[model samples]
Target chain A: MRRYLRIWRIFFTHSLIQDLEYRLNWWLNAFNTLLFLGSSALVLWVVFTQADAIGGWTFDQALTLLGVYLLIEGVTVVFLVPNLNRVPQYVRKGELDYLLLKPIAARFIVSTRYASVWWVPQLGLALAVILVGMARQGTLTAGHLGLLALMLVAAIGTLYAVWFALTTTAFWFVKVDNVSELFTAFFAAGRFPVSAYPGWVRALLTFVVPVAFLTTVPAEAAAGTLTWGWALAAVGVAALLLALSQALWRYALANYTSASS
Target chain B: MRWRPRASLGDVIRVDGLRKVYRVHEKEAGLRGSIRAFVDRRYRDVVAVDDVTFGVAPGEVVGFLGPNGAGKTTTLKVLSGLLHPSGGTVRVAGFEPRRREGAFLRGITLVMGQKQQLSWDLAAVDSFLVNQAVYEIPDAVYRERLGELTEMLSLDGLLRKQVRKLSLGERMKCELAAALLHRPDVLFLDEPTIGLDVTMQQQVRRFVADYNARHGATVVLTSHYMADVTALARRILVIDHGRLVFDGDLSALVEARAPEKRLRLSLSERVDRADLAALGRVHAAEGLEIELGVPRADVARVAAAALARLPVVDVAIEDVPVEDIVADLFAQGRAARAADAVRAAHEAGAAAGGRG
Candidate 1:
């Protein structure tokens, strides 16, 4: 475990350095994230303008949920998409050969091989938004903070699990741009809390794509209203997805035909 | 019949009847074809490696010389476990490569000059560090190995530059260093000095020779450059159309596959092409000079006949150039493949009682 952690650190730092290689790129990405975040907040503002609350979520609770969505987005963009999204390209170009040759797990290397630092500004802004919402509510506690951290792990794990499983399928399909795009559209549903939608839509958000685990659970934890049942469900879903994805990745490796060189 | 390096008991590498067939999707031109392909794709099986078998003893540097798409790279990939063969068995460093066990991975390294393992936007050293961590090398040992490679590869000033910014030769040197940091017992280098300046190629050649000598690592290298093979490997494997056509000592290859010898005669006068054609294939007829392409076994007989009959003043016999022989070897392989196709077609016609 320690060895894997050490290798991950090495990969992480180098990837960050690579992302910073172009000075303008870092600034541009940061600016792009902030603009997207601003547009998202505007949508929230317009939603609240029509009514005091939607589906029982207070303005503060909804704001915290949006912040959680942004936080997860920044984390995945920085650490997950750059790697998982390129699995097809790696398989196409035969780069997976070198990765597979490594003594460690190829999945581990591919997952942690790159991480961008451009998400820093977006993550900082997200933290500010979440804290502001919590301050307005004045109900956050040490226990609640601990629960939020746990929820954050579960959220990131769930996100990585689904993306990795879908991406690993590229080994067989080799192209799934439209499918992934549709997934992105589904993920964008997280910007609003599950409570904001009707019963069926909430079910889709909570169970089908699990945008609820990504945002609502963490947001609820930050809001100090997360129930034991929801937290258990979130953790269970994350673990199950992780196990399934890892198995798929291994099966894909065994069937991997290195691109004709 | 073709020669195969016999597989010994303790050989570091052994391959027997190895084959790989690629299933390629075929599509026709035009929108109609595209839509048809979407509904029902046509597939073809390309035999990339066909019944190739060879073995390498520990510490032997073997050259895999073949024409493009002749299965040298494919065979290398199969040996390294990056690919699974469609038929037969292979054992590299005492492990079945397709399994890619940790011990097997740790025992071998593959370097392809056309591709890179380094991060494009990061310094070469960063990639090395990643390799170091992943390979689980102790810090002190990693430093010592890096220091040695730095000196031997003249990698002193090259490690810190971004991989994309480095010159090809510099990047190649760094690649060699990165690949060898783990001190693998076997090395698979596919065109390690391709596309470099002659001087750099020589340097790479020298480094590979040195590495093999120092560490006693078994090496399997492939290149179009005969000079690369001649300088580094004593034994050469000539593969064509996914089959091992020739495998033996360098001198033995020259002795066996060379098409013909040149018989040069300084005659008292220019001989008629007719007269020389009777003796052998007429190559050239100049003033008081004649050259004939005499079969290797008939060089002496043809020379003696020329000396006895023609107004011959001087005579000499020379072997055909090695380069021409190599080119002819590939031509022969192509001709053989064509002949096989023709024979197959004839048998098919005979069975079907002729068509067209």
Candidate 2:
């Protein structure tokens, strides 16, 4: 575990240096990330102002959920999304060949290779919003905070599995870049609680996309509304998904043609 | 581990009837196949490797030679475990390469000229350090290897500079250093010196040779450049059209295929074109200087007799180059391939016509 962390740090530092090369692009992208955050906050503010509560919580509760949603989105953008985007390029250019030859796990390398420094500020801002919302609500329990921390870690792990499985389709389908984009579009619905929608819509969000676990379920734990059974279920589901995705990645790697012409 | 059977160098690397076949999606140029592909895809089997078998004793430097699409890289990929073989067996350092266990991957390295492993935007030193951690090499060993490679490749100031800012040769040197940080026991170099100046090319060749000699490491290299092979490889493996055509000593292949001798002349005056043509084919000519090809049997007599009669300024006899020999082999291979293609087509057409 320590060795893996060391490798991850090295990889992160390497990606940081690479990203810093285009200083102008970084600044422009940083501003763009800010715009995305501003728009998200504005939309949430307007939605809460029009209603006393969204689904079953007060304005502060909805704000906290929105804050967690932004934080999750920002985390994915900073690390997972960019690395997933590289998967198909690796296939097309045969760069995956080198990655596979390494002693470490190929999935680990591909999942964390590229880091987007522009998303850092947005993540910080999202965390700040969560903190501010918590302070305003007061009456925060230690157990609730602990559960939120566990759910946060579990959310990141589950997201890794989801991204890995989607990107590994590059092994079979040469042009799946648009498919990944469509997946992100579908996942955008997770910003709201599943209970806010009708029964069939809630079922679709739960079974088809599983976006509820990414946002509402984690936010529920932070808001002291999560059941212990659901918390165990979330951890169990994340472990299963992580295992399944890694198995799929290995299988796809075995079937890889490596851009032969 | 110490109580296990101690295997010798002879069994270091062995391959038996290895094969790889790729299912490639076939699409026509027009919009019709594209539309059809969206609904129903068509695929054909491309046999990238067909029963290629060979072995390298430990510490032997072997050159894998082939044309662009002749499966040299595919074979290396299989041996390195980047791609699973469709059939047959491969063992390197007594481990299955496809398993890609830490022990197996630690024993070898593959360098491809077209793809870079270095962090393109960072200083070369940072990339090397990253490699050091990943390969888990001790700091002292990393420093020593880096120092030696930097000195041998003349990468003094290039290490501190960003990889993007370096020239092609400079970047290639940094890449070599990164690849060599752990000092792998088996090296697979694919076009390592593809694009470099003459001096840089020689430097790389020397470095490879010295590294192999010092560590007694097994090395297999694939390249289109015959100069790289001739200077470093004693044994050559030639593959064509996804099959092994020849695998033997370099000198033997040259002697058998390139038997003709070259006669170079710096004449005192311009000789008649007809006269030059009569002796042998004029390989090259410029002003009073000329290079001619002559059969081995007639080379000595032709040179001696020509010098006696004409005002010969300078005359020399040398063997034909290895590049020409490989070219001759490739031409012969292509003709044979064309013939096979025609026969296959004819048989297919006949069968279809008969069925109709």
Candidate 3:
């Protein structure tokens, strides 16, 4: 485990240096991220002004949910999405040969080889938004904050596992570049509370794609309304999905015929 | 060079009846064909490697020689554990390559000419460090090996530059350094000298030779350039149509396929083509020079006769080139396949006659 962590450290440092080389790109990406956050916040503000609550949640609650969505998006774009998106290209171009020859796990090398540093500022922005919502609600407690942290970690794990399982399919189907786009589209629903949708849509979000675990559960924890049952279920679901993703990755690797065979 | 006895050496790589079949999708050209393909897709099985069997000693440098689509790369892939074989067994370093155990992966490295493992946006040294971490090399060992590889490959200033900023030769050298940082026992190189200039090709060839000599690594190289094979490999494996056609010493291959020598004569005066033809098969004749293909047993006699009977000013004798020998071998393989087809047809006809 320490060795894997060291490898990740080296990879992250390399990415940081590469990212620093293009100073203009860093500024542009940061500006774009801010613009996206601002637009989403504007939409939330406009909706909350028209009604006290759209789905039995107040303005502060909705703001906290939006913050959760941005935080998860920040993590995905920074670490998981860029690397996972390259899996199909590697398979198609036969570049995976290099990865396969490494002494480490091929899946670990491919998934964590790149981490985009430019998107990290969005994560900071997400923390600011979440804090602002908590300040507005005047509900600051040590126990609630601790629970929110645990729930946030579980949420991120669930998201990572889901994304990983989807991208691992690229080993078998080389043309699945659009799979991540499907994830993004489904994840957009997390911008609102799962309760806002109908009963069936809520169940789909909770079980099928599990976007509710990513946003609603964590947001509820921050709002001090998360039940013990939901928190335990979220942790259990995250563990199960993580194991499932690992098995799926192994199966996909075994099915890899390699290009130019 | 003379052929040496290889039976005394212990084989580190043993492959038996290895086969790899690929399922490739087939689609036609026209709109109708496209629609038909969409409605009813067809996939054909391509036998990339067929019942090929060979073995390599612990320190042997073997050249895999073949034309395009002759399955040289496929064989290397199977041996390196990149592609699983459809049938048969392969053992490298006393482990099944397909299993890809950590010990197996650590003991071998595969370098493809067209593919790169360096981080393109970072300095080559950074990529080397990444490899150091991946292979879990100790800091002291990593520094020592990096120093050795850098000096051997003349990669002092190039390691600090971004990989994208380096020239092709420079990048190739760095690629070699990165691949060898761990000092793997077995090296699988596929067209490692492709697209390089003559000088660069020679540099890479010399590097491979020195590295192999210094480390005693088992090297299996696939290349179209005969110079690469001739300079480095003494034993050559010739593959054609997914089959191993020839596997033996380089000199033995030349002797079996082309039992002749080339004699070039610079005459004092122009001679008749018929007079030159009487001595040997005239390959080419210019104003005052003639090239002859003489059998190996009669080369000395022919040279003496030409000097005594003709106004020869200069004469040179040389063995047949490896390129010509390989081309002839490929041609012979084609002919043998054709003959086998005809014989099979005749047998079938006879069987049909008996049935009637």
In terms of lDDT, the best-performing candidate is 3
The TM-scores, one per candidate, come to 0.90, 0.90, 0.95
How much does candidate 1 score in TM-score?
A: 0.90
Error of model 2, residue B240, in angstroms: 1.6
RMSD of each: 3.6, 4.6, 2.3
The digit string of per-residue lDDT tens for model 2 on A1-261 reads: 776788889888877777777788777866876787678778878887888887887667666777788888888888888889889898888888788888888777787777887667778777777776666677367877788888887877887788778888887786678866776897788878889989999999877777878888878887778899888878887898999998998778766744353
Interface RMSD to the true structure, each candidate: 1.8, 2.3, 1.6
Global lDDT of each model? 0.87, 0.83, 0.90
| Top of the candidates by TM-score | 3
Runs in model 3 lying further than 4 Å from the true structure: A258-260, B1-9, B267-270, B286-288, B311-313, B349-356
For model 1, residues A50-76, the per-residue Cα lDDT tens digits are 989877788888888888888898888
**TM-score, chain B, each candidate:** 0.85, 0.90, 0.93
Candidate 1 lDDT by residue in tens digits, B142-192: 999999999999998899988999999999999999999999999999999
Where does model 2 exceed 4 Å of error?
A18-50, A257-261, B1-11, B268-290, B338-356
Query: CA shift at A212, candidate 1, in angstroms?
Result: 1.6
- Model 3 chain A: ten consecutive residues of lowest lDDT: A252-261
Best by DockQ: 3
